[model samples]
Target: MPRYGFIAIDDRGREYRAVDEAMSEAALEGRLRKAGHWVAKAWEIRPMLQKGGLFGGSIRVPTRPLTEFFLQLSMQLKAGIPVLTALSGEAGESPHPGLKRVVQDLSERVQSGQTLSEAMAAHPKAFPRVVVNLTKAGEASGNLAETCNRIRLYMEWQERIMADMRQALTYPAFVLVCALAFVFIVFTLLIPRFAKLLAELNVPLPLLTQIMMRTSDFFVHNWAGVLGGVAATWAGLHFGTRLSPGFALLVDRAKLKIPVIGGLWCMIGMARFAQNLGVMYGAGIALPEALGMVAGLTGNRVLEKSITELRQAVTEGRQMHSVMGSHPIFSKLVSQMIAVGETTGSLATALENVSDYYNEVLPRQIKRMFSLLEPLMIVGLVGFVGMVALSIFLPIVSLLNIR
Candidate 1:
């Protein structure tokens, strides 16, 4: 479908201008007439390439700010403020230039007679399919305020989980980087000087020292090859994920089997799925449609495949809990609860409960992993430093004893 920009006069004699997607200019004009607007003019709008600014590219508005924007918008709507007023106020007050641009665009579209959902759909980067669908559902159900609230809560929850995961990984990442820097310094700079001194003394080296020196020499001579190999491996994996769905699926499945992080990944996926599905279902979205929308939120190919299967089964009039139980992604407890919810006619509540369960347990699991990781990393760092020190000093001590 192509977008057409139009100018029209509404039944109240107010002129409106908007860009809308339609099959042709005639179709867009017909839509405007049907909605009690007299179309003045309509033209197809083509996309233009935006040039990068001094910052090198477009500014990306982060999710936390979006969450706050929606939270405020929802409150304003709940207080009986008009959509245009809420949007204009938000755009005016927003500190993020990217968000201000999006909100201002949305306000203009809405003023031009487009629905809020339609306006948001134009900016998919800022407002995803799930948000657009929920907004559409709210428009249909006359509950846009509640829908906005749900979107805010969902984004806030997701941001918090991501923040926690990042925090948990911070110490381990720092330790790994420090260890790599230490090894690089020793191999490229420190070890060679020690090796030269040992050679001048003409003493027999210990097996460990000889091995370390040989390893350092190899690295010093082949650092280019080592760096190129690392870069090639990273590039290959990055492209593989983008180009091959099967490879991506295998990688996602393997991610769930990694020792401490795997369980956290599963929990995060489940929580997101449950929360999104619950909100959409509660807002009166059909099960199949809700399942289809929620599938994209998982960010894992394996879980997405299972959800797609579940959606197909539901479309065929099969019991959702029964179909879901066949997938390992849904735990036994979750399956049982979903079945009970379906039987009792409260599936949304059941999903919300599942989400709450994960939200509570996820933090504890992250904390436990961090507790174990800290000590393990410290011990590894100490052991590595001790080995390097021994390799360098033991030879010098032997030469001293001989003197």
Candidate 2:
């Protein structure tokens, strides 16, 4: 749609600038006159930069600034400021150069009479799918402000979970890196020197000492190969997921079945599924359509398949919770809450409760995993050091005895 920016005068002789979409100036003037306004100025906005920043068409706006944008837009809308005005203000308020540019574009687009959600849809990276869908619902329900505020909360919750996951992994990751570095030093430098000395002595080597020498030689010679293999394997899996659905599904299912971490991953998926499902359902989107909205959000193909099943059941006139029993990915508590919600015609609230339950559970699970990992890492480190100590010391003691 072609949008035109315009200055118009109301019956009170007050002037205001706005954007409206129309086929022509005549059409736009006709519409404005119906609202008791005279067109004073108008011009077409052909945006050159489009949806993103100077870097590229796909600008990655940071979460904090994005959250701020949503919050401020909601507050401004709630205060009765027009969408274009609020957007213009946002363009100015944002410190992020990319966000500022995007907001400026959004303001111009809205002025051209595109809805806020439509403007957002243009920047998929800057505006998330969930946010765009919710905004659409809010526009339909005339609850855009409240919905945007809710979107802010949802995003904040997501960020918190991610931050917790990072924090939980930090100590374990540090330990693993340190252990690997120490092992490399011992294998490549210390062990090689000791092996050379033991070789010069021409004495019989212990079995452990021989094994250590071989392992050290492999590390020294094939370290680059090991790193290349790791990188290649990771790349293969990462691209395979995007290129082949079956492979992706297989991997995702395996992820969900991992002994201790698997259950936690499933819970994370469940929480996200419920939260998104609740938002769409509460937005007055039909059950089946709402189910579709949440399909790929679970981050697990197993759970994604479950969403498909739920959608099918809803379409087939079957209760969704009834199908839940068939999918172990969903817990009994979730099924029961959804069942009650379906019966009460408040499925949205039920799903929100389900989400709430898991949101609380995830952090505790992460902490528990971290606590367990600490001791395991310590024990593994001690065992590794012991083996290395014995490998180097065993032959020395034997040589001393021979003398």
Query: lDDT tens digits, residues 154-249, model 1?
Result: 888889888888898898889889988998998889989889988998977988799899999999999999999999999988899889999989
RMSD to the native, candidate 2?
Answer: 4.7
lDDT of 2 by residue, 278-314 (tens): 7777766678988887988989888899899889988
Q: List the pairs of residues colliding in candidate 1.
A: none
Best by TM-score: 2
Please list the residue runs of candidate 1 whose C-alpha ends up more than 4 Å from where it truly belongs after superposition.
1-7, 10-59, 400-403
In order of appearance, the predictions have TM-scores of: 0.86, 0.88
Global lDDT of model 1:
0.85
Candidate 1 lands at a TM-score of 0.86
